[model samples]
Target: MRTLTERRLRLVGVAAQRAHDRLGRYPASAEQILVDYQGTTRSLIAESLVDAWGNPVQLKAGTSFDALSLGADGAPGGEANNADILLSELLASSAPRPRSPEFAGLQRDLADALHLQFQLDGIDYSHAHWRNSDLSVEQIQAALAGKPIPPKRHGPENHGTEPGADVSRADRTDTEKAADALFGALSGDSMLAKAMGFMMKMLGASSQARAMIKIVLADTLVHADAILQAQPAPLAELMKVLTVDRNTQVIHDLRAIIADEPETRSVAVFYGAGHFFDLEKRICSELGYRHESTLWVPAITIDINETGMTAAQLKGFRALMRRTIEQQLKQLD
Candidate 1:
């Protein structure tokens, strides 16, 4: 019940912020927020304008706007569930100023959204793809900060060795070898290669497709894991270790950080996009966070012309892949 109220108040705060952006100033009151705010949905006004206790939320408009909920009591102050909830304090809005004139418009929005997503006052956590125990958090931080990455404790030189090399061959799994072969086939002059290249180009051209692909991949992993049971496939096990287990550890750390450091205002979690759905749910449900915004950045792009496939060829290939994916999903179900 308390969690639901906090989430609703967070949405109200988001609406107020959106109103500020559109109006060139914050709304004068909560009532104004309900009436004047333009959000992604019309029902947001009804859902956000009041607290869970059925009391009208109060808006404290000063130099900065704050959406206030007096809590379950509907009074100024009280204890336990009746304690005041301040939206301003709940949301993280302290983003750094743009460094240059070029950082205007979309770039500025991305920067602000990222800062708003995670405001770190105490400890910040980041996870890298490598499973090496030697790749410490400090090392990851240094690498992210553009410092020279320190050598791995055990086998830095072994990385990226020729596939036929004894160490490399021994280290490579069947799944990794198959992935490498699939990638190798993409450069061939065969019809399948051309089709695959066109599909890659199509994905690069459409951000929505890219996002949907991530969702599909995540869903497939869940189904695969369930089907494999105790004897899971290599890819599913690897994904569980990399995405699921790692996310669990990160959430545990976040929980400890919040509990130990009450003054900590913000927290930044740097993780791959595939891992976000579960992590976001855990944070919002367990740690009392509410989703406000998202900033999308393309990781890969390919020119369609470079693929040497005609428009018709591309369209046919895309449809084929879509049908194949749908069939596979149905089989999984």
Candidate 2:
């Protein structure tokens, strides 16, 4: 049973797949085919096929994406489009996807940075980042005002609060008080990432999901203290309680990034693993992946107990993550 969100995400995957499949049968690059179909410039095609939010879709096209992007506006322009993230066409592919040498150096640079980040010592290396999960502005404000945070799509840790509850941390978890006991107490990087993923899945994400992704990506370089310093007030204290310091900064940033760019309009977010049982269709519409030659966008499931995290399990976790990324890349492809 696919939720509306999953169905929507399938739109992007379907569109991409249609374009990809056409290439094998009819010919022409994915961009060319789409341009012909939409009768628009490659740059503007994404904006033509609007999502449920009624916003035009904007894609950062490539064959095998290092990362598939929908930009901040979820339309065409904004921080994401301008960010140094997706600078050029991702030409690498098993299928024909606009191969060009100009993007080669850019690809190498990104790959190198990504590889380094993956190898960085004491990098936490878990899928979980230091990003602060987004609390709906209304929900947080209500909680601050001593009102109920909205019932959010939260997990058991949250005890089923309103979607985007504007509230303080609930007395859930394994503790009577969340004094930073740390997740996966007796775990490694893979387990930690999975734990974080589990936490997120139990909670549905915000449209600011893109913002959250940004924070996770930031872990590649940006300092945690730096991000906290950037934010103001009690929010900082709240972030601290979440244990999103430099050690877990990336994850926190990703969540914060969502609310950071709200003016951009509707956006969809995807966690690394299948966590949600029911997410909206609007989000799934703009972004997605492919499976068994059929395109689909289902809630990603995180691995709570991943193998190869410890010294004895390194090889296994590495392979697991690689397979996940590889699958993601193909979806974006």
Candidate 3:
């Protein structure tokens, strides 16, 4: 119920804002925001003025307009789900949505690197990137204050607490599901998997072989990492869509919240580790933030013996993968 109301508020409010801009005055009512307002097809209809609870949205016209949804109770004041929702507040909260320059540069650089790497390694680097997930300002503050982080809606369609934002996320989620299915089907026979399998065998081998292969494999894996940094699988293009592209909005929202709350002394952004590199650069370069400290947490752990490879073979196989990956990286370089 609140979800539908929020969407209408944003979409209808945006149309109303456009109408206001052209006429230099607020619309007399919600219905005055037309489908073709300012040559944009917002698809708004008479129903756009109707709130989720079947109450008409209250529109007060002035130099600046105020729109209101009377909540589930359809009354002036209430609490919880029945609380009043103000359109001005909603728009103000999300007003700082323009993409920052640093975000744009980082995205371009990553895409270029991925394209070049794919040409050489025939591997997708897209999965190497950070995945996008929402963490609200209130959640971060709660964590900082030693309180429990608030629970958020979880699943494919609920990318954000606000219903308006979920529209874009839904499209992204669909792409991600398809990409994941494709990635799973190809991973078994993929060169990366074979190389990893071989490496596991090397890890189980004798110390002498381990020592030699470790040095060589280390050098090779470094190069392989470079290749992984450069390319992403075509189907996994959704990885970039989910990780890099969606990050722009997240960063924009964070910046807005920060700006809106001038008294805030500290803010902690929580995201996948892969995202931090670019995010740090953006915050420092664009938002006038400085580096403070670092905390590392292990996200995953793997045991080599579980792969069912004997020691000697595992050592040799790792060396082979390392060398092959190194050569590929060198070619790209």
* Strongest candidate by TM-score: 1
For model 3, the superposed segments whose C-alpha errors exceed 4 Å read 1-225, 232-239, 299-319, 330-333
Each model's RMSD to truth, in Å?
14.2, 19.0, 24.6
lDDT of each: 0.57, 0.36, 0.56
lDDT of 3 by residue, 20-58 (tens): 766788787655665343221333445668898999998
Candidate 1 clashing pairs, residues 3+ apart or interchain: 119-266, 119-267, 120-266
Per-candidate TM-score against the hidden true structure: 0.35, 0.23, 0.33
lDDT order, best first, reads: 1, 3, 2
Q: Show model 1 residue runs off by greater than 4 Å.
A: 1-237, 331-333
Residue 311 error for model 3, in Å?
9.9
Sort every candidate by TM-score, greatest first: 1, 3, 2
